[model samples]
Target: MKKLTIGVVGAGIYGNYHIHTYCCDKNVERVVFCDLNEERRIATADKYQITGYKTVKEMIAQEQLDAISIATPDPYHFEPAKDAMEAGIKYLFIEKPLATSVKECEELIALAEKHGVKISVDFHKRWDPAYNAIRDEIKKDEDTFIRGYMALDDIIDVPRKWFTWTDKSSPAWFLGVHCYDLIRYITGSEVEKVYAVGNKEVLKKEGYQTYDNIQAILTMKDGSNWTVENNWILPVTFPKSNDGQLVVVTEKKYFKNESYRGVKSFTDKKESIPNYIFMNFTQDSASGFGLEPMQEFVADILSERPFRTSIYDGLQATRIAQAVHDSCESGKVVYL
Candidate 1:
């Protein structure tokens, strides 16, 4: 295998995965790790045995990197990707919310096209075997209903960061986009309309912009419907038999999965009982974090194949997510 220089921008929680993945890659040489926080960057670089840089510009100026992974926060996708493309990097694997706006997305796409660099977004759901199974299950179905949910009560992390909070932006943009992208992936449709209703009722602080709970109805191009009930405010202390729950219900067969969770499949017989039964949706069966997906990306690039999750997918996901935000405020179904 020919060695190719690879680099990663940002060393936050998710960015760490890129570092780990690239370090283990046989074709990747000279992995540059970038972060604004010198300490975090150094710590991660030391841990992974790679060169650490405080700025992406410096890395591009010095390193002969072929491909780079942009793992910064949702808003920072453009800067690093734009820089990498300008510097003639061969590939970019950017984290979600590819760009904050559609125009920016178009600009980035145009830049990638101009530079002949492949851009891949970290829509990790595309790699989940369960999602693949679901896609396979519904491939031939003309009429389909794909319903699912991603719920997590308000989460308070160690330092209390930007992502898990109550802002005008609910977990919908942060978390719901994942489900939305998966829906598009499975159903092979774009959201034709979006209508949402959400409230921060339970996470009721005096003044908060984000809603902890949101329910959205997605109208697909095929005239099918996908509903998402996103709850990021479910109070963690309330212990239950289950930790988290996600069920994908379709007309013929449905697959339900959870964290510390159960996975079950069932054929709808029109019984009054719950459609999916609880079986072993065990830990081992679930796969999302980076290593495998990054390996797959590398494999695809080397083989001259396109990645499953490309920039266009991220753009579509962002379009639907923004529509969800619009729906929350408009109180009407907004056409996508």
Candidate 2:
């Protein structure tokens, strides 16, 4: 058996997960990361006790890495990914949406092929046991699909405080891509067209130039329709930072699921819902469907297995999201 050395790009919130996840994997011999922020890089390096670099080029040149993971912001994913691939690392596990634009996604795909690198996009929703159960049930039946409704929302603080790039990312790029990818994974279909509408008042009032909420109707190639709603302006009083609902209606059966899986807690300061299934990190371990994709990425690489999702899956999701935004701007249906 061979152990692997891994390098991670971006050392922010989600980037920390990538760093911690690879460190926890038994087959990964070493884990290193790069971040442009000197403060974050120094802190993360001291905390993880791993070498940190200022640039991907520095990390690639110094470390004999077997793979690299990209955890950059939604719009900035392309540069780090291209840098890693062009540096000759043969495996990658990228955080969602691949890239904000279809052009970037296509370019990344071409580069991956030319370099013989195997790429996996971290669309972790596919790892949810509930969603998997729903997919299994639908597969066992011979019924025609009718419609689906999905809405994913984050607390207002997400865009207002969590990131400085809120203006560069809308709800469609952040939350909507997860919904779009989940719909495709569940139904084994592709989106054919989209018509969308959105409002920007909430974020605009706060000086962020982006949509507060967006709703899009998707016509799938399988002839089923889906309505996806995404927003990050939920009131702070909401128990969880995020919440969602999934409902599907087929010819003979109806199914539903919610992000809150029957768990709640109340405290003097506030009420809360802990999504233990999504992600839970203890002193020595990390577990959850949310973190499973990273673990699987290392295992699959060592075992030479296929990834659950590919660059093409990332490309299609971006295509749908781009169309959704286009429709919102043009006030008309956009065919894909």
Candidate 3:
């Protein structure tokens, strides 16, 4: 077997995870980090004991990469992804909400096809066992309405201090895209239309030009509906970084998953709900759900099998998210 070399763009939170996961794989020969931030690039490289570059172009020029993962911020995915595919990287894995715009997603799909490269999106929610059960149950019934609320908030430090590009994204792109993809995965339906409303009061007051909250009503092609609510304005003291649930109602059965209530911990300083379903480091490597989806891409590349989550899946999710943004901007329903 030929050892595969992998490179990661953006040495941030998820970028570091990709590095960690790839390092644990026996088939991977080398892993490199690329980021515009010199501090983060050097720090992550030093932490992981890997080479680092200041830009994707520099990394690709120097390393013969077999695969690449794009973990850049939401709005900054298109360029790195395009470069990776055009560089003839065999496999490309990207964080969710494939791209900020529908046009970008379409172009990426076309480019991947043109290059004969395999592409997968990191919508890791699909690997959750509880969600998989829900998807199975929903697949059994054709008429099911899903009410999903995924409210993930970062401490004020996230937008106010962490990244300077918060204005380029919103809760819809940052958080809602996950919900949209999960709903589509569970229901096995495409979003036919979307109606959304958003407000920007809190973040704007803090000098960030982005939506603090958004509520979107999505009508699926199956005629069932999903209501998704997203808000990222939680205070710095919020117990958990994310808290949400999914409820599927049908004529014959009802299913609900209170993801946050599965585990709990509290202390004098703050409360916390450890995310055991996805990326639980307490267990062995194979037990973690977070890395399974990315591993699927690796397996597909090595075995020449089909990817579990195709580039089309990423494009469809991006389409619905882009529609939500359009509806929010136009203050009217957007038809897909």
What are the runs in model 3 whose C-alpha is more than 4 Å off? 141-156, 282-287
Model 2 residue 76 CA deviation (Å) reads 0.8
Global lDDT of each model? 0.70, 0.93, 0.81
Q: What are the per-residue Cα lDDT tens digits for candidate 1 across 1-336?
A: 777677889888778767766666676666787899888987997887778898898988888877888888776788889888988887888888787677778899899889998878877766666656667766757446656554433343211343432353456666777778887887777889989988765455645556666788887886667777766654333333223445666667676765432433344542122212222123223123435567777778888899878889878888887788788887989898
- Which candidate wins on lDDT? 2
On TM-score, the candidate that comes out on top is 2
Selected candidate, larger lDDT, 1 vs 3:
3
Quality of model 2 by C-alpha lDDT: 0.93
Q: What is the lDDT of candidate 3?
A: 0.81
On the 0 to 100 scale, the lDDT of residue 90 in model 3 is 69
Worst 10 residues of 1 by lDDT: 271-280
> What is the lDDT, from 0 to 100, of the residue 93 in candidate 3?
91
Clashes of each: 12, 0, 0
Ten consecutive residues with minimal summed lDDT in candidate 3? 278-287
What are the TM-scores, per candidate, against the unseen true structure? 0.82, 0.99, 0.93
TM-score of 1: 0.82
